[model samples]
Target: MNIVVPVWGDAYLDTFLEYSLPAQLAAGNVPALEGSGHCYTIYTTAEGRRRCEEHVAVRQLTRFVAVTFKSLEVVATYNAGNKYRTKSDCYAIELEAASRSGAAVAMLNADILLADGFIREALRLLRLGKRVIEVTGGRGLQDPIKTALDSEFREYNRIISISPSELSRLWLANLHPQLAMHYVDGPEGGSFHPSHLYWLAGEEGVIIRAFHLYPIVVKPNASPVKFSGTIDDDLVALLAAAPDERLIAQNSSDLFCCELSPPEHFVGDVAWRGNRKSIIDFYLGYRTENIENLEKEIIISSKPPVGELWDRTRRDSSDFIDTLISDLKSELLRRCAAREADDLMAKAAAEIEDDGDFIKAIGQMLENGHPIPLALEERSLRIHLKTYPDRADLLQRLCAVLGAQGKVVPLELEERALKAIVELHPDRRDLLERLRLVQVGLGKTAPPAALVSPSGEEASQTEVDFQQDAEEFGRAVNYRDMEPEFAPILELARRFTMTSVERMYALYKAVQYIEATQVPGAIVECGVWRGGSIMVALAALRALGNTERDIYLFDTFEGLPRPDDDKDIDVLGNRAINGWLPHARGNERSNWAYASIDDVRSNIGLIDYPSDRIHLIQGMVENTLPAGAPETIALCRLDTDWYASTQHEMVHLYPRLSVGGVLIIDDYGHFQGARQAVDEYLAKTGTPLLLNRIDYSGRIGVKVQKSSVGWLQKLGWR
Candidate 1:
């Protein structure tokens, strides 16, 4: 019987070959195509070779053709359409008999060895409304993942392989290098494949044992070829460089002895030397190494020995001794109980309705300060909504999540957005402070503009005065960074920008900030809740023809990754009300809602700026730095009210101020986290400006500056 075997990038072909009976037609005789269907066109050497030829005058020549493409084959061998095992439509196949009712199709895993990037790619394909086969690995058969899996012959867009052991070490090395290497043994079922995966990380030895008792001929190279594993940084580099050594072993330790080799003959000459075996060759079944008086031939590769630690490289500077001492010191004098803290966080993140309300759930938990994991990230998203209180502020959600989580969070959209905003405006404290508010506050929509003009052209003098006064009120309430006395803005009032709907969201934020601190620029509230008043200031700037000066937005777009030390933070994803959850880096950008700087910039357009003056830096404030950081900032928006973030912004942005620049904080009125960080920072640096509280509605704004003259100037500006 004539048949066809479709394969992926040549890695799994032999596996299928071991189980199938080859036709009399030789292996090299089958035609192969790189990227098309009908991969192999087989012909009889001297007679008719029919796929299912029933010619009365001719005899059929049975042959097998191997194709590297994906196609559905209809054969009578087995019924796969109704009983397919997976959800991958883009897979390979070997049509043993497709001319009749049921057929045997090889559903190849396309996303072998790739990670982070594919999940989104698959989703993107699905979002275009395509039905993609979701591949996941877990013990549960009734889980949502299994329902998502399909079994078509899917295309292999990305072919990557990795060692499961290596993946564990890679993850650990990021957290602790020595610790990762120490425990990188065994098949850790802990690492399961996500939905985008076409293939899972497998033990090569196990596959080799089933494929062949003897070694196949594969040449050695300078760069080690990848077999299969997590498609992380190391795995990608390895696969791009060298071929894997395909060998089998009895135990895990013997994996080191595995070796891959190519045919031992020169290109054209078939000097059929001794048996094809050095030790365990499959070609001639354990042939001797010596040929009759033949010259020594060596298989030279492009690179050297492989699997040497690249990502797991541990330098003396980042060794265990240093980390151990640091961790030990930190473990002392801890205030909160560990289990209690974890329980509190988990409780904050659990049990939210998926009405996509976005705010109700996230706002509640952030107010409670919850953490999240993969199993309950959706719940985290429901909580993040409370942070913004504005549907249009969707892009800012990632910064809050990443800041609350860590550099690498679970969500991809959150990761990219956080990185972009932080990169564009690291010095802007409002980014962190607003993110904190998103972390802590219940999500709410922005109130109608308290300062608005129907024409929407410019703010009235009365409205401007109202905004200026609101700034003053916030300053009056702030006492932490204040001295004996300080003058305030005369018209302590609240005002909004001359815009509508989305743009008006900024006004609610300004009102909130205005209520937070009353002092114009002298008494500062570092982190503003919701940023209503700050948005007002930016609108005020646009109204006053300062469109050339950019309003920078800084944030950890993923709402802060898990905190490294003793720091107060809101629940994860709470800051991003009415938006998607946070995303980790190394994933595709499409998965993220505010994954790019454009997402953040797009949010600012609602403010009605000249469109050129709105700058965004997305990342952890510490991790995000502009190329040529300014020497002295004119207006330092300290939105990161927490001690660590506030401290970080001050250290970085303080040096960038011009004389008489304003450092307006969004959280000078509340949040002990901000208060502690600001106090210690000022104590160390000797800034004597006091924080006078401002209250315009529920927001807070503070006036901060270099001197009394700066304060006076700030007051005049307000």
Candidate 2:
């Protein structure tokens, strides 16, 4: 008899020779055929051969059976990328070797261990004209059982010469009783036995059959074609062979084997028997005459046959088995629910018609205590509100959830929903009050006075005072101390900005100065990377009741331009360049400074800032500032870090700065080029300005003295 094994990587090769191969040989599972002139052929890589030679078990096996190592590369069509195809090609080589030697071939997985007398029985069956013998009743050793027993078996050093019967005894005694005992007094008793019955119905008719075929032995030249390495490869091989010559052995007697892992798509433990049945049904459906017609009609038996021995074992181990089944069921349900939720969300995202299903999926996830992402939940609720606009209960629930989590609700969606609910039930003071509070949260000065009265009457003094108090309380929350009011700002900073809190607060203070001093002009910002600083300013403007100003934002919006190497070199002697830092020439899109115009627009939209008030001028400061900038700027934030752009902005925009207007120099302390531009402009114009330090990199200076000299004359260009 010729035993063929394909050992691939170092891990599989080491485990097979060290543990499985030695265990099989010690148990007398391999036939002692040294004098019979038959040999075991191992097809493996060159590395496999180098490692195999170091194994003492390989020398021991040579004493019983001739062991030959052949290069797996002999399969000229071997696909290294597809492991199953590689294995199939190796098997083809094994078949060719067996046919040439005129010996029966035992095709074995590298990861399996055979029982004593198994090879002898297979060869005997082959001699009786059984062209193919497929072994059944093979037990899969779960990892925990395999680990514990392999350790103990190695500690005892039993691999050199343990009896074959002892191998079965060791496994049967230690395996979970639910998997170990099968039948009483039958051939497969005291072992794990999995039998799958596949039933399929199609246009051709219904066919019911059992499918279990692996660890096969074949007579020389019995298999006609090489295996395809697909899931149905074994079935294809069996179908190709003459039926009368095929034998599905009743395995536990001497034809048993143990697999290191369960078959693909099948989980360990009795609870997952449904998965095994489903896998078999699926594969068998492919073999039917019409797969599309058979897919919906196919069904497999979920319950496997349980013999009297299993019943008796269940009585003794009922608690353990029940707990295992319960735990597995819970885990399986969780995974199924998560997958269903993901599928529903994807479907809803792909098509708006599935929003109802999406909502139910979120509700189910919430009930199951799964963490639904805030964005997903918000989307689901938005869809639900859109579909059923009159659902006030859902609107209330949304508000309560957002309030408890302190999450920013999609302001536009929530506001529309609240207004609709308030309109529908004008007498519901509670609904009106909720709408008023939502409006206040949204930075509205007050809910329209008519909204406070159902009959279009103005709100009384008491109601007006109440609204003012609420607004004051909303603003007075100590956000810098990490109050709940800071949650949305923190979230915005995390998503949009790479600036320190001090710098962000400086932007806020700039907004405060414009609001306090009543400086009249649109807010201007240069170098709006992802618009983080500008977003902070906008949020502050809304919070401080100064949202009327039109904001001017300037950026190349394609990331920074190629910096002047002579003028923009950093303190570390690395030139400031147009890419991700450190090497500074590649991966421009991934750089922290890179933000497309659309990204800034999206960030601004998140806060529901009025879009008409935002003027995003997309170009270098040198070109865009002169043409597109606001005529009178209350807040002139210069963040263009290079000397040329900074100097140009200082020359063109500084002269227009309102008296008492805030001038924020974002990189004054960090970028030498920016500091040079600011200092040069201040010196040339003789402007007396107090530049206060905000952080390590930021400076804020109120424009106390407007420059008398024109920007062009100050640059000596006119």
Candidate 3:
């Protein structure tokens, strides 16, 4: 079916926007109205085509005249006619006009409902009666692949797959879980920073693409003896000459891992082969709305026959009367013209009883297709913006405009050019309440405001010094050690909140988001330098009244892994000359990861957390998470400072996360290098993105069951 949408001015689209939909966009920026295709030109010219093909900027507005249609067999197999039924469905209606319309056969494919059920039924249909494609059963009554994959996904080779930067984050969820964010580098190897999330998602574009619970096998499918140039280009030759056929995946063909570290090999029948467009949503539509068969296009207008005719008929001889009536006619024509006069009158009336903006809207109608300055002049707004008249005049008039549109001056940031009037005048006192807005985040804390002094002024929101407040909060938070006051928060939490989440263990530095009960073994964080967080976690676990489970602290006493063969730069191929971080400026890697695990263990020894309960797995989590596995992991927190360490922990123990288990990632947020590892893992794997944060870059969260949904549209699912 053919669809059309009109593009118009977005009142709240930011020149510099963030991940969470900004308040301006959601609050009042009206959605473009769609009815009949009325206001667009299709991309049809050859030169227009050339401009689209070569230039990104020029091609941006290239709208298509999309058309989707199918033969009898294809139509039955594909579409299932969902688009024709629902009005609010998101599949189409965004399509531009397309140049080509054609029909094709649709082969069936099955998706297993694991990634939101798009292709599942088609594959089932194809398998039932196909002789051309033999269906060797995937599983009889028993599904072996599912069973084998699940067992292998968790704790394979004991190495977790994560990037370097994620290992250096702040608050972790307290267990192994998937997190997605964008953190790759620009030209200078400078990292890109965005608010972090700790939720699960399968495929995200520029973030962690794909990751999940799976065993990691490091051994190559074949011996290292044969050195046949690039395996990708010479796959079949290498496969045929290989010493042992046992290594390849039987009945699987094609080389997905050819460009990888070790080329992937499989000896099998054709796994999957098809035209790329077969997977693309084909906007096939018949030239069904044949205009030749259409009824006459017509519009009915309600009208009162008046004006010159009425004046003449009534013989109104007063010149003043004539001028007054003429002015009335002009005012109605200007404002009530974009769509309807009555609707415009209603809108303006809602804002102001008098039809003043209506008069302006009439002029705006006259100025359509004109330059913006001319349009403003036509509407008479240029004069008002230019001449404030006086402070008294400005205030009264601004108030009148405010009353008319019901718009308020911004209150949060005093220097907002858009909200500057409030900063300069009476509305400043209401900053706290009038600023009833918060970007969506993992927790419920208000994020900081824009730094007025920022050079750009518009895009930057710097972290402010709420130091005294934070100190007070921390002091209050630290009071759990000696008092019964903090129990009230939990009491309040229990009374007011309805969630299964209860505190398992609490540490100041470790991933405390995990709810640990009497778990079988100890809770361990490998690189605990300053005992602050871990002590908090341990104390909280003690506070939660679960004293049975232990807390294990692990680290390389000397600090950091021996910068391996690939450790000189970044996992995504960036140079790391010094320890300088993009966001943290001059802090060294040592500053981030260096800490005496022994010293931390000693300091926490004085707390209510018992020393015998705390075990130190010194070295790397690559060695630790695996060694501690099959020990019934209640919670696993990894805070090593690089990609290698992050990967080590994730691959090793994330799947071992018990039912309703929690895994916390420390550096998934605005941390520069960290989120890259996160985004890459999210995008390329089957794992999901979790918990998102707004104000506090240091966030806390939990994990859910494995998802059938690939791209979850939630706070932190990316």
Candidate 4:
């Protein structure tokens, strides 16, 4: 006997190879049949063939049986789009292949598990002069039970013996109690379809009567009719059997087979409609001239058990519909309650003026799964922090709620809250750990030693005052308003850059700083990936009517230069520095980081910025900064991520940065190397500069007065 299987898709193939095939092999039907001259053929796609071969090698399936694989050529019309067409094509091909073998063939679906001794029982009937054998033991196993059975089989390396009672228990658990009761008492019992026969294992072995019989095993040359996807399987069985040959329907009590329910073995009204079309097509195709005879045959078949099953089905369906209606009503009531609760929360939030009460209202909304506008929650939290700076408990609760909702809280507020919590509770190692994470998320390497007391002492009053002052500065710098003219440019720039709107607003602020201070110099950007940031600066410059200032855009214009592994490690301990290509798998140009110089020029052209004033210097910053960079810079933006690049840019450009010029460090908080380079350069210069936090990963600092001496003393007249 040759066992022919047709399977497709990764999911079905995985289940078939992992569970179905293993069950058959364990049942002594696969390798055990080699002595009886049994072979196996699997028909699948090219990719599926690769998977099957891999499985065969890993499981050594060929060592047991002479297994052969055939790749079914995928036809665009038949095997590509429609699943039904694919199934039909596979069956047609497998049947054709089986016919050529000149041996008894058992055609089976890939997504089914055969019972122990099923093949032997089929062969016994064949030896007893049965030309075509229909094995009636098709049971429907729900997904969860199928998963459990697969797990058990894999763990034990054999099919675990499940008694008929246990099988029935598993089947009933997946069904509603009312539905299960009806099914158990119905004419079909546990079978997949109403017209199908069902049998259970008992002391008498297995006893089954024919019910919409399917030809499980066929003798050589007996299958004259070709099978198709458009024709039902049972109809194919009926047509395949020769008029002179004997046909028998039987099942061994020791043998059983089950298909996974819901999907693999579909049930209910939709499945019936689909199957009915194919059955009707088969009958029409069987004898086109005998329409009357076909109708008579259908009427004859619809007598007795099917008629009884139909009446039972109607009654069961009525009960199921009533239960469904009750469930729907309960669902509607639950939704109404949820909506009322949401309205109450919104009303409370709108009425509440106190910052503390407002925070509580927002938190409650989040806890109850009510949607709260991100801007509203953010503004409320910021206001609460201003009024009650030491309320780490409320802050933590709000932050946790925001995190759970996947809402991104401003990193500044998160850092401030975590610092207060850590300082107030020095013994809280968990809080300290959380503080480190927040710091890393801000693009900083680690929390400074001074932030955490070594002796576990509570934060002093001065420390609290400093935190309050920092919070005040953050509020002062928050760019809440978008200038009307810059809005369109910002929108256009978004297409070229991944920088947040907040960061872009900060850039606009930098332009405002230069305008107010009358700082005279060009705008210099060290790492211009796609020229988005430079475009923002150009827009701001244009808005301020400072079109005369030359903007020097410096970059490799390929991607990021390779980082120094020892000095450029991230907080997560990843040495690969390109954020665009975190794993550093392929060439730098492969990802978003690699924008061409021509593309940047084209993007600038889109905004109609002064072409000559914009200097698109293309090369590594280390090499280009020495020759291509501007001599004097008023607004310098350093986005270079590596330690060496950042350090070099600071060494060459810091001196050229005029007094009161704004220096924006884009990767200062996110990249440890970038932060370290900025800190080291600032420390060497001994400049009294205040690096204000802009966003999570950006910092803006104005190069202020270098002298520590008083104005009068510096005059030398005193």
Best candidate, TM-score-wise?
2
Give the per-residue lDDT digits (tens) of candidate 2, residues 1-718.
7778888886577558866686667444674443586678888888888878777777767778888998876653332133444566666666766656667767777777665566666666776888777643334554654565566555354463333344445445443333322222223212222222222121111112223355467765643444433322343353355657776553244455655553232222211233333232233322332121211211111122245544444343334334434544465566468657755754554454476666676666544434344456557666776777668656855654454344655776577767777776678665566666667778885644432322325444334565655544544543445444545765675446656666777777678777887786778888887777788888887887655567788886656766776777654344576322422222222222556676789878776676646767766665455645655778888887888989999988888788878899988887788888889998887666678998768899877542533453466632
Off by over 4 Å in 2: 76-79, 137-139, 142-210, 222-224, 230-232, 235-240, 262-283, 288-718
Name the 10 consecutive residues with the lowest summed lDDT in model 4. Answer: 294-303
Summarize candidate 4's per-residue lDDT along 440-507 as a digit string, tens digits: 77888653333333232554423455554454444444444566776787776765665667788899
Per-candidate TM-scores read 0.27, 0.35, 0.28, 0.33
TM-score of 4: 0.33
Models ranked on TM-score: 2, 4, 3, 1
Model 2 TM: 0.35
Which is superior by TM-score, 3 or 4? Answer: 4
> lDDT of model 2 at residue 672?
82
Give the per-residue lDDT digits (tens) of candidate 1, residues 55-115. Answer: 3111212222332222233221111111111121111112212223232122222111222
